[model samples]
Target: MRRAAALLLVLTSALALAACDRQAGPASPGDRGRLPLAEYDMPEDDVRVVGTARWTLAKECMVRLGFDRLRDLDIDPLPGWPRRPAGTGVVSLVVYASDDFRYGVQDPEQAARYGYQAARVDYERHYREKKWTLPEYLALTGEFVGDDPKSVHGHLVPKRGCLGEADRAIHGTVPQDRKDPVLDLGAESLEQGKRDRAWKKADRAWSACMRRAGHRYATPTDAASDPDRDREELEENLTDPEYDLNQPSAAEKKTATADARCKRRTGYVRTVHAVDVRIQNKLIASNRAKLEDQRRWNRDAARRARDILADRS
Candidate 1:
């Protein structure tokens, strides 16, 4: 009976351990110093929790950066009078492969291979711009990845991006910068028209870059294209609040403009949360049904990444 009890105890312990493993998170390769974002070490769940996390965190980052939670816009000719909430965002997830991972082991692994790198860089740059504004966090960027820093070329920040390895060789995020343009109080623009024109040009350039980088164009070319279907997806993203339709740079460029704003819009940060993520339309939840389909792609992405990395490693 004592022996039987010991065996049962072992079984119970093993089951408990397994359950804990299920709840636990994956390892976070980055550091915890002065960055605007938090690096979580959660296990990759069956659900695309990472994508959800990315969306939540990116929104949180934008809120911390300045703007109120995102509002929507009406670029339509005959705009619908009755509008809806801008909805939850679409988060992109990409996982790299073995060949590319090995290449990353070599010097010069190209991030364009996985288009997600651009937005990640934008996030980091955006974080820095905002973090620096507060004197208390002046050193945020300095220790971003912590001590024993990898060479910039290393898979360190994932900014240069994942070379495509491990269980899921991808990094993820929601690109709030794509929502719209805001004033770069630190940057200098010419005429008001020139500035607006620059913003328009910059938006086009970034859109082109998104395509080149392999992102599906999220915006609909035509509102009548799919009507409800199109409206649902577009509304659930980084938005352009009227408050964000900014004016001019308040001062001269004291620091290099963030790379995230590399494509440019009338940019900079006063408090920062005010700059990056702006939404035009004020959202109201109409259906009360949380959109679940949008996350399908991200889940497929996460599973595929795990499979590819498993095969490679």
Candidate 2:
């Protein structure tokens, strides 16, 4: 569930909030390889819903339990907060709780199979696109993408792309490595023994992140071409204590943290499929062994190429 949540959030969030989620994608490679559903029949009474291309509820069972389609949801972040430390993505809540699989299966066991299978495909694509490192993923499991598919940020997955778009704009390749002054402030607070101060800083950072999505946190770029003049001007401009990140918005402080975070620009592909399943089963969902095999292959290949490049120099 935690794995799914991380992968699902990107796709789910776009579907949930984007003014236009682009009606799924044209036939994907995996779509052609899908197995027929007629192969299995295990349930007479089960709750299931299919056809995710269009939004519909499987069952509106209870208060707030029944789902309804919405044109879109509001996603703007709170204003007057410190900007996210450069290149921070817009932050928002994402929820996905479907009583059915997009591929149409409801046989509990089969449902789990079809459901998690689809998740694996998406997951693989996500990892491939993001070029995710396993360790970084493990770190974020506790907070951002927990064990619940229903509660996540949801925009982690892309709607359509040949390969996952690697955003060099934000710098950090791994989820946790990305620029996020919100979390950074939290750490600082813990260090300072000032929980209240930390929370306040975090809130400001989040607000900034949510608003200034897609910005980069760039570092010094060799004196900005003009060299001496640029450096002198920049020094003069920054001479004031106004750049201090500890201070929140005061009509003067315009989210410096966010600016700091999003100062760099680069791009890479994000992977979708991370797990490799050997056989499509009923009860057991993911095959850790297969997944690890694929991961090891990718890691080794990348390492060798990088080593070659280093050796050349």
Candidate 3:
């Protein structure tokens, strides 16, 4: 039952995750952190407001359908909405607010503090602590009764549940199979950028730099993912049961710091950014119509969210 309820939570919020994985582009020292595809994606804060409104509407609908006890849960319905900078089991649900570490950890301070791990947030923990009842889950996820009508406490439930109804009210059903063009282009751009000769050259330089620093990694990504470290941790855990495998090790900190410095020294971030921007611009030009439609949808959703929030206030 717990497992089913968890699945319901995922289903309820799947629409929000379908949007985009946040905007990414080059940051030049101290700019507004704009990128080639930033204009096409909804700003992070707007996305948050929309999420809040959707949850608010869904919660209200739940009460109307007789789940009044939820009104006192006093827990945040939205967690990891805009994406936190650091956390365990990081899931990219929407566009993040900034370009910081989008191309990996560029900030030495952050690298020092977190190594390859993102700073932890309690989003996942919150969900685990607050479990929803099965009936509440059904109300949020719609009927599992096939084409037959379903009701809870004598009130009919929406086809897709209160969450789906709220989603439709804010996001609408235009472009039934909605797609996020900016996200598509951004992914394409990264692949194309990694293939660029300049990026390869910078990668080679970074690898050599890491080697000189006593850490041998073909790429910064490899160093961050660090399966080798994971293996070592697993082996060590057999002998010392107190070892927390997920925590950053001293070696990881050293490697991460070296990685940050090496990236700066080898101009890796700049190379990738330049290549990505070039590819992304070309992609945007080619997919202008799709992107425009996505932008239009985002604007409409944001407007509806604002009105909903305002009415609630």
Candidate 4:
């Protein structure tokens, strides 16, 4: 359930940021060989431009308000993960599968030996620690209405500090009335794919593969959310006082390997990718106008951002 909620949040956030309004070019027959989902995904270049500009402006604002120390303190955009061709598809399935196979565990022996726990621990220990001072935080996140005051340049901060000011300067506070229909369209497409004859046939083949592997899962999702696995986890947590729930156990590693192998053998990922491509192309065609509007907004934003950065430089 937690995984499901996280997936929903990621999808919704992506769709909400769908601001490009340009029409996609007609897909060539050869284009089908490439990832179809990439066609409908957000423009990463535009996002980077606007984000860099916002950071630049916020830093400038902070300096103007007498927090010059933060001027040299590097403020940067959070590094994004390397995106898969299918965008959020694999992430959406994380609820049903183990982390080992979530991104495709190529070497099962290596995965079992090292497990999936090392990187997370390193990330928390290094990147997740507090790296910013209070003034820097205030500059980036704006002021609160009911907080005890902190002095920056011996002045009580105004409501909605540097971050808010920078935001207002670039993209005004009045929210756009438009909504991105991609999420609704994507959901509709998934349903349609489920009913698609080809998808259904592929699903059956995958299910048969799982059954052969001694797992009675009707779908990858079923394997991901296996009741018996959940029950075993619960029992283990209850009985073992020293068990670390965050770390994948031996049983989990075994299950993940089988799940990955079954998926690979049945070509479930390819099937799902094909279905998503067909649906997304149709959605793009129907929603050209909205997408174009978003594109225009983004282009304008990018232009303004460039201008702001240029002036500073």
Candidate 5:
């Protein structure tokens, strides 16, 4: 579920990236290939550009307001935050947005190399590099103070501070609602995809293949999300005294490698992705009006954001 949540958030946030328009290019190649739903999702490069533009505007605002210390902070610093950092190589900060490894380690090479770990490892490290102080938090959010009595460094803090200023400049006064129909449909499609007969059959096949490979997980989720794994890892690492918990264990690598191989042998990725496509196509057909409205809002926001970024550049 956690893995799926990561991918789903990336998919839905594609709408958020639509705040700045740049038509996506060819779909990226990956284990799960490109699904039909990707036609509506923003490309990772566009998301990075738009996100960087937002971050740049906010940083400029902070510098102008004499808060240069906050310059290096990322705009969105949570897990699965999109936008690859400099020198991160092919590590995808957006996780498997372009691809579809939400079903687990679908790529044989990735599974053999990194096991179940994804970009979240590097992203979390980057996120932890900067801790937000109270002043920085206040400047970033502008939540506690009322309409008349908020001043920092003898200058009146604008409503929502630099972040709000940047947002308003790009997206105007429109509220970025979480209740988007497209996002709702995406969640629904994923949930429904799991219930599909083909999906279940593939899961069974994958499970049998895993058993043959000397693992006993009934589902990919079971293999990926075993609660005991973390506790056992902690116990094992406690004896070493120098273990990096972030690094995948030898056992994990072996298991994940097997999981990937089983998935490939059993056609799990293909089956589940097809199930999702069927489910999403139905949802999209039923919710065209709502989706269009969402897209229209995003297009307008994108135009504004693009112009603002261009001006700054």
Candidate 6:
């Protein structure tokens, strides 16, 4: 049941990321070096309004089904949206530079104050104790029915419960079948940037910097996933049974700090961003029709969401 609930949570989060939109203006001539606009990206205000409305509707549906305990549960912004830097009109290098850097331990001092392993311990412990019944979980996730056909409770569930109801109320239909062009474009652009000649030069510079610092890495990804850090973590776990495996150890912290400094010294971030934006702009130009269609769909969904919320109010 817990596993099923976790899967539902993952699905819901994915839906939010793919379906959510924000309003964006046309790119200025001076912004030619920036990442190309995906027509579907919504303004932050629209995202917040739509997100809150969906949460409210879901909560109301759950309450109608006699599940009131969920009223207190917090609904987080869609993944990647909250982390986006403002006014950049892009997910910038700062995302990898600040608190979110090196898997959320960007600063050694911050890591020391709040060890990595300790962050999610409370949430993990709470969920492990079986917080919700299987039926309740299914209903909340809009999959009220169990997967098995022979189950006794199979006939008692609705085809779509609270979450699906909320989606339908907002978008006329659940956007389960739609493909997210923005995510696809972002991945392709990043891969292209990695292979570009300019970025390769930057990677070599970063590698040299790391070598001078007594660490050898071919790329930023390689440096971030150094195996020595893993070995140290294993040793720590074996030596102290009470040690939290999730927490960043001293060795991991040292590696992360070095990795960050190398990134700065080599200007890898600027190099990659420039390459990525150039490649993405070309891709966007080639796929203009498809992207425009996606943008139209997103705008319609946003309108529906606004109307639904207003009617309720």
Off by over 4 Å in 2: 1-24, 28-90, 93-110, 113-313
| Clash total of candidate 5 | 2
Better of 4 and 5 by TM-score: 5
Per-prediction RMSD in angstroms? 26.5, 24.0, 7.8, 9.5, 8.1, 10.1
- The order of the candidates by TM-score, greatest first, is 5, 3, 6, 4, 1, 2
Q: Residues 77-195, candidate 6: write the lDDT tens digits.
A: 32121222223222212101111221222334544444333223322332222344555545644432224222224333344555567767776665554565765786688788788
Q: What residue runs in model 3 are displaced by over 4 Å at the alpha carbon?
A: 1-32, 64-66, 72-78, 81-99, 119-162, 173-177, 238-246
> Which of the two candidates, 2 or 4, achieves a greater TM-score against the reference?
4
Q: Tens digit of lDDT per residue, candidate 2, span 189-265?
A: 23333223433343344334525553222221111122454355456657676653222222211223222232211
My TM-score estimates for the predictions, one after another, are 0.18, 0.16, 0.71, 0.58, 0.72, 0.66
- For residues 1-26, write the lDDT of model 5, one tens digit per residue: 11122231212222222221121222
Q: List the residue pairs that clash in candidate 6.
A: 21-42, 22-41, 22-42, 22-43, 23-42, 23-43, 117-246, 117-247
Whole-model Cα lDDT of every candidate shown, in order: 0.23, 0.25, 0.63, 0.51, 0.60, 0.52
Best by lDDT: 3
Worst 10 residues of 3 by lDDT: 1-10
* Deviation of model 2 at 57, angstroms: 38
For model 1, the run of ten residues with the poorest summed lDDT: 1-10
What's model 2's overall lDDT? 0.25
Model 5 lDDT, residue 125, Cα: 37
Top TM-score hit: 5
**Candidates sorted by lDDT, best first:** 3, 5, 6, 4, 2, 1
Measured by TM-score, how close is model 5 to the native structure? 0.72
Q: 1-313, model 3: which lDDT tens digit per residue?
A: 0000111112232232232211122223322245678778776567667767777887889999988887754425463222222222223322122344446667677678767654231123322233455566567756343233478899988866776788888988422245667756776887888888988888899999989989888877788778888787677676876776546677777788899999888888877887777888899899999999888888899899899999978
For model 4, residues 53-85, the per-residue Cα lDDT tens digits are 666776777777787776874535321111122
